[model samples]
Target chain A: MALWRVPLDAEQIDVTLGIVHIIKERCKGCGYCIEFCPKEVLEFSKEFNQKGYHPPRVKKPDDCVNCHYCEIICPEFAIYSIEAEQEQANP
Target chain B: MTIAQEAIREATSHPLDDLLRTERIPHIWCPGCGIGTAFSSCLIAMKESGIDLEKTVMVSGIGCSGRGAGYVKLDSYHTTHGRAIPFATGMKLANTDLNVVVFSGDGDLFAIGGNHFIHAARRNVDITVVCVNNFNYGMTGGQAAATTPHLAKTTTTPLGNPESPFNLPLLAYAAGASYVARWTTLHARDLTTAIQEALANPGFSFVEVLAPCPINYGRRNKEKPLDTLRLFQDKSIIKNNAHPTELDVDWEKGVVLGTFVNNPRPCSTDMYDKTCRLEEKPEKKTAA
Candidate 1:
């Protein structure tokens, strides 16, 4: 919904919801996912993983569109997204 | 387990786990190195190419990128430095049905294995070569490599590299590659697509991937990993089917990326079977 002008049929189209998952232990804290994410949904967390590098956290979880850009861009296979359940999408 | 813990466990299990060596979780790549992205793209392409995984092989040469063979859950070969292509060629010839993919670094391919690369391409070998060009000898303390750009700083070339870099796409095209393409690590989606296309090509296919050597090449050049990624985003232009001659790595003038050549030629195996095997079969039949 980060559009300049809402589409006329926006309400009719069911937007696919996504749940961003971050595996803190595997992350190297490269920040590629944070930088390239189209939705700007992730941000660096203050807490560090075992490697002492800060991993990303979902800032606006609802904004994720299941594009999987973060998953593909993540140098570490530490993050991924699965489509949210129907109940979570409605909620 | 609590629901939250169960969810966390499920989330941590990646889709690529089946394709990767699970025991090798947490690869040795640096925080900002681009090889991981390139390697993952290759894995995705291999999965999506719909090829027979049982008969597929991954080969690597000695380098940071060469560690790829160790991480994959496939029949892989970790060959000697600069010999990945030759080994892959042998595999393809011996087992024509096997899908051979040579994944190695620019230094390993173009520096020590340059002759093998040209010869393989010239013969139109039925194999796919993915070269990750990080612009320096990363595993060897950031030394200047054959793909190091002019005036780039490296441990060996502190004052800046004096020699020009090779235009890999042009080299592959001139050597008779049936398909050639170039993509930076930032273009992960396109890179995967190109790899898939290269996988499907019948003859020699070369894909040159531009990756960031933040620890090695970038440290001397004063470009951080993020800065290099930003440059890749702002400076690269997509020109599909562009002449191979125009495909050079010029960061200042913008980098050209896309599939440059894709015309099929009779591959080496087919030619050999047609000329050599055809004659031998007739002689064997007459003797019988």
Candidate 2:
């Protein structure tokens, strides 16, 4: 069991954050990520990525529990979850 | 399954019947899938456990094995794939009194959920996990799962699986699963006992059920449900891990069958709560 800990705190006002992105190229379409997420945040995209596998696109970013079920179940090392970037409105 | 059958013994309190969610019947599984047999076995264990119904929380991830949590009528949650243990951990920590359990499949537990499996075992969380191994993943057209034997024929591996399969129980034992045992559905009587023991044990308890997927793996191997079970009875040579020489047998064609290991450790929560104490609740003042 590989445990990856994101040793950071949540920052407010994150816009278009790159929290988690699918690698599409290596995905085997196992659907483990869609099946295991505590939050129904991921869905199989209608469009197939360059890899020819239907990768999961984040449908609801706020719902993620970050429990890491997706990162663990991905046999192909396709999905990587990271902290969302902080977005600030210009004063 | 087994636990639910225990309900029959009373015939009066109807207490066991109360423990089952009647609405969830007519479960979706292929005929002759050992999951059903294993399910009944689980039911009997819960019935005999004498534990309070409300306190037992069955948390499960996806796949056929995930259905094990739903069969029981308790504070149950059919959680997402490979997430049952963490959900179970949360449930246990939130209450600390409930008997948290994870009923899941090999693909859910060892493949995608493998990391959580080890951490849960290492933490020695106060929970019981029963992983049903049917070799291949039967739910998805019999694809080769992590539990499938190397070179076994599966849908994805039409030629045969080139990857090595897991020694599920050994992995658990290594990661500090305090109470660990492996039993084939053929050893239903033995399995019932292991479940009983796991329910009672303090720390993380794991039991691997070597069950059959007749429609999937069995079809290729040309075996019926009982035939697969009979193999466990006739050929399995594993007894005590240290005393293999006592039994004479060919190693390849046979799988080990029994309640192999049973060790108890201090509950993980007990240790965690000892140092990191949460602040006490403040008293609310009554309106003057």
Candidate 3:
């Protein structure tokens, strides 16, 4: 497929973004998320999912811009992003 | 402990999860089939259109593409073969508030459902149609259909298809579709944009999506899944508002893709209501 990074302008980027959740079994191993990630933050894991497909793994989590291109291009809807929880200050 | 492990901790959540029939996941479509992409584009369009999901209904006829109705978590109907248009038309006329969309294949739309296609456009039915054209009957083992290109090899045309394929954009434009466009599965953004526009249009709007049937159509023609996509990327030229007559798909040369028609016209419902009002007023005075 033609993998193009869809730029989302006018959207706030969550600087404290933690992780992109990947539903292992649901990933069809299309690699669309990895190919379309503008940050080059993802790679295919050596371990296979239940379907024997290699789901994407976060290679550089801190580089993520919180863009939803990976989530949108996932034909199986297996991947999504979430912001990290704030660290509690000392009492 | 690891980033991969952390990411896989929870099932990925998406806004479209509720919009899909998840139980039908790992859908029946073969790997690399373009229907999923086309269907996703439609869902994105519907979501972006800001239409009331509760008041929208998707109607589809029998084909590989027809399976879309079953997958979309909407008031969708997998109607009889080649009847998606008429079924959606009835839904629209029964409740004008509902946004009726007909999603089906080229064989279902232009072969058996062809008469309905012409009549629906001629009547200016208020509906959006997404026709996924894979060039052959994928469901029925790749038989040659009305849209199969001339000299293409299909199961039904073992030597070569001697018949000329219908120029779909021209056909739809000539048939009186108010908004007409064609896109490939490779052009997801363009397809989604056109679909969004078609959904918002007032009268009959048709969007033809050229998709890949990698298993049935591709293997027979020596095109693997990615190779099929390469064809689309290499051969497509976008020309918005180009005349339909110039938008023919020639595999050797290239295919022109664009939103060819977007002129608004009075829909059937609007005309019917106006005619009824005129006759009702005249008949009341005569009776009095």
Note the residue pairs that clash in candidate 3.
none
Which candidate has the top score in lDDT? 1
| lDDT against the true structure, each candidate | 0.89, 0.69, 0.84
Error of 3 at A71 (Å): 3.8
Question: What is the C-alpha lDDT profile of model 1 across B1-288, one tens digit per residue?
Answer: 346733653356787889899789898889899999999899999999999999999999999999999999999999999999999998888778889999999999999999999999999999999999999999988999999999999888889999999999999999999999999998899999999999999999999999998999888898899999988888999999999989889988899999999999899987987888854353222111
| Model 2 DockQ class | incorrect
Writing each residue's lDDT as its tens digit, candidate 3 over A1-91 gives: 2334444862564355545777888877766568657678889999988888888888887776665667655667677775555211210
TM-scores of the models, in the order given: 0.92, 0.66, 0.86
lDDT of 2 by residue, B68-170 (tens): 7776777789988888888888778767778887888999989889999999999999899998889888778799988778778898999988987888777
Worst 10 residues of 1 chain B by lDDT: B279-288
Badly placed stretches (over 4 Å) of model 2 are: A1-91, B1-17, B241-253, B278-288
Q: How do the residues A1-91 of candidate 1 rate in per-residue lDDT, one tens digit apiece?
A: 1332577997898878778888888989999999888789889989989999999988887788887888887878888887778435553
- A41-85, model 2: which lDDT tens digit per residue? 688888775646677777776665444445533433346454443
If both were scored by TM-score, which would come out higher, candidate 2 or candidate 3? 3
Indicate whether candidate 1 or candidate 3 has the larger DockQ.
1
lDDT of 3: 0.84
lDDT of each residue in B50-121, candidate 3, tens digit only: 999999999999999999999999999999999999999988987888999999999999999999999999
Which candidate achieves the best TM-score against the true structure?
Answer: 1
Docking quality category of candidate 3 according to DockQ thresholds:
acceptable
